[model samples]
Target: MSDDSSMLLDGLPVAFADGQTIMEAAMAAGIFIPHLCHHPDFKPQGSCKLCTVKANGRYVSACTLPAKDGMEVENNSPDLNDKRRTMLQMLFVEGNHFCPSCEKSGNCMLQALAYELEMLSPHFPEFYPDRPVDASHPEVLLEFNRCILCELCVRASRDVDGKNIFALSGRGITKHLIVNAESGRLADTDFSLADQAAHVCPVGVILEKRHGFAVPIGSRRYDVEPIGMQVERPATAGTPGTRDEQA
Candidate 1:
């Protein structure tokens, strides 16, 4: 590969360092790439394909794909947009996303992305997957029914906090709740309020107990604008580290 540090992403040239991923590069260039699992404070797990983009004539997860010199990337192509819409629809049907009742309705990333894609109604039949609510902890609420399985909290717990508290269980459509350690309760687990996992949940599934109804609908950050437009990439640090380093 060439030693150049810039690449053309959707007709716009963006510069990136040697180790930056395509998602990071695109964000740095002010290109909005819709994502749920990729958070700046957490490690990139790439579980959700919402950030999928065409690079060098191939589909790749921007969160995991390394940006290469001279590589051509198409982020907002018709095909990709269609795929994203379909994916969002599937996510909508796969879980019980009742926005009106959700505490995180306005600030939720999933809702914001769905609105951005214009998913007014879920066209597919509801999965209606039965998932138990785990509200054992006094400070945390675990509503498995609303989880998209984006694994943001899981990754944040495991990688950033070095506390492997949250983990997904089962496989395929049967995939259900997350277990926190052997006891399967947040309180029983070694997780603390300080753990990044507690704050990384994109949905209202895992929420801080105190802030349940703190922010009303239509007043939250994502409610005003899509997360892509609301959040800006912070200045990159000169050190080598995980996404937490940048934040």
Candidate 2:
């Protein structure tokens, strides 16, 4: 018979409450499962597919897959990691991510994951898509070139900020992030730097102006510790549910 409150994660026992997803259970147990689109504060969106794991011989998104008693989840396997590496590489090349110059470098989940997954280079040809840099907002800057389409901003804006200032448009390779304004400008919306969406981005897409490199390169969040370790330690996740908690 299956235990009602526990399961096996990678051959290790893990206990979880009812209604917790595999990712949530793993996270509560301090097990690192690579993910991009799922954050604790928002409803799980499984859009990134980085958290896909083998659950009882079937592949499913850990973020959205409910944790069942006695279920065995395969995470961190070589096959899974290899696939995740390829996905990370695709994300890197799909967007214009100049990490060295990005304000979000050490604090960026994507860059940190690339290092964690040992993705040395963007394995595919760069699209180098012509995106815009919207500095129309005085306190914040929107660099669309580095957006990975994780929709953190979209969820945060609509759910938390209640502005619905950001949204994803188009489809597939043509899909891109868009400001929900008639002029296609962030300033045209009521997005403020204080909003939750402004701080939830995993990449360099949304940044604050006039504060670039304020934390320095080497002393930043992921610079001091890998993302996995940070996730395991909530105290170091930044601001106790405000800053970098989604990271």
Candidate 3:
């Protein structure tokens, strides 16, 4: 398995293509790396730090680290999993993620990763910060309570939608997502439900109006199965195509 184009991921050999990052190669090889900020369509930001992996005796962001030949990558381990779980817990407490009442409960990547990581509890005390919900837009709701600051929407809006509608401002604990309008309101912006940014959010931060409970509680995306299974699954249960392919 020690080929010129292969790298060792958890002792298993994985081939990599030129210019592919560790996350990209592993994902293409059916390996599921826990991540929130990484989407197949966008450039890897490594902002979430959920996909951290031990590489060559040091830790590196899998989403941004380039895959090198003969490199040793430890993705799944007790210590690594604990760190990932703690990260997930921190995200939960920092944000007001009430899954029971959240419209994106099942479809939310944050919630799904919590379930997949078997996050026992918040582990840390809740911050309970009072964030705002902007419902001024006619077709969308900006629920700050569920925002994880992944910035996928920001990238999608700027890079794909060709509309610089989203941006992150402030710093540290005060950091939050913002719209690019003078009024600081989504209604004042040119955001649309059909915009690529509208669909890139991993959590319930950005949601389309009138379809909060469209899929029902029990039949939503992750309710049917774990997020790991969903992404790693070769088929869409009985559907025609692969989720990875479509994603």
Candidate number with greatest lDDT: 2
lDDT string, candidate 3, 1-247, tens digits: 2335988999999998887999888987888889988887778889989999999989999999999988899998988889999999999999898888887877788888988898989989999989889999999999988888999889989988899999999999999889899989999988986687877678888877887876777876678778786654222113353221211
C-alpha lDDT values of all predictions: 0.77, 0.86, 0.83
| Candidate 1 overall lDDT versus native | 0.77
Model 3, position 25, has a per-residue lDDT of: 85
Task: Summarize candidate 1's per-residue lDDT along 121-220 as a digit string, tens digits.
Answer: 7889998878788888887778988888888767777777888887788899887667765677777876666676766677778776777666555656
User: Per-residue error at 239 for model 1, in Å?
Assistant: 19
The residue pairs found clashing in candidate 2 are none
Where does candidate 3 have its weakest 10-residue lDDT segment? 236-245
Global CA lDDT of candidate 2, please? 0.86
Instruction: State the local distance difference test value for candidate 3.
Output: 0.83
Model 1 ranges with Cα > 4 A deviation: 1-4, 233-247
Write down the TM-score of every candidate: 0.88, 0.94, 0.91
Global fold similarity of model 3 (TM-score):
0.91
- Considering only N, C-alpha and C atoms within 3 Å, which residue pairs clash in candidate 3? none
* Model 2 weakest 10-residue run by lDDT: 233-242
Top-scoring candidate (TM-score): 2
